[model samples]
Target: MSAPAPHGPAFSGRVGWGSRPAVLVVDLCRAYTEPDGPFALPDPGPAVEATSALVEAARASGRPVVWTAVRYAAGLADGGLFVRKVPALAAFAEDAPGDWGALTLEPGPGEPVVVKQYASAFSGTSLAATLHAAGVDTVVVAGVSTSGCVRATATDALTAGFRPQVVRQACADRSATLHDTNLADLDAKYADVVDLPEALAHL
Candidate 1:
């Protein structure tokens, strides 16, 4: 078995914050982060607005802004039973929020908009390499489905050698209780859970 990380969200263990921090918006696509859309989660409107502000701050500091969108090929062929099981996910039309309108923020000249299929942004995606190439050692994470995509991406970020800070107030899910519960877990185990003000305080 792999040894537990010597340091986690609870303590940095003397590893100071990174100089290059990026903003990673996970699964903010129209499918997940909307109210009346296919595969919509919950009240993701305010969360998206908060994320937009965070992106602005990251840009002001000249940090890379990475937005992750979820897209899978038609049929259960590309996504297997995962797609077959969630029939609503099949309705993600290219013209919908699945295209990520609310999640759209101008990437600085060299920023990235990563496309993904699964919950974890790092899964079958170039997120790790992209962040590394940008010299980003810390990621400010925000997104939809607090119990799903956000959690998955946060875990992957930590595994791939980046400090991931989950913006609790800037993330949402289908259930308010689920949102609060997942945020608690993320704070205790997966990632550092901080609200928008706390995140902006550090920035």
Candidate 2:
């Protein structure tokens, strides 16, 4: 038997990296990175290392870097239905012990950190305006849970009129299947999924 056809011809259009790009690190928090944490992935090291390289390359190129974290008020008053749906999010509550929501890759001076309650980094946040103010025409997306926050943020970035480039090696998920599936979807419809070297070159 032959394999199925790819998602091209219909969703083949590519929005290549623009002239001005900013690395958007989404939800690379301790909750997902720490092995003992509730939301830890099977293997977070590769994604973390790739994302760190992307961040470093962006900074060295003098490009802007934005970080996003999921934080909710005590009792999840700010998380809305998302918290109720995924109780694991309690790890990010303001009063949660050990600051589990803290970013694994700390933001540097002058770097903007956007705290959100939902999956998408651009949802209910100043991320669009921040990117606009920085003259960023493209978003180099990285971070945890490729099937969740990373996919959402990449879609929203495209919706907000910015080119979205999802670094394939810089995003992780609970499983390899989940990560690969979502990256394929994002590349077909919303973002251009590229490798770390390609992303670094763009930066």
Which residue runs does candidate 1 get wrong by more than 4 Å? 1-16, 93-109
Write model 2 residue lDDT over 73-135, tens digit each, in one string.
898888889988998998898888988988898899999899999999999999999999889
lDDT of 2: 0.92
Cα lDDT computed for each candidate against the true fold: 0.75, 0.92
The TM-score obtained by model 1 is: 0.82
Candidate 1 least-lDDT 10 residues: 93-102
Among the numbered candidates, top TM-score falls to 2
For candidate 1, what is the lDDT?
A: 0.75
Model 2 earns a TM-score of 0.96
In order of appearance, the predictions have TM-scores of 0.82, 0.96
Least well predicted 10-residue stretch by lDDT in candidate 2: 3-12
Best by lDDT: 2
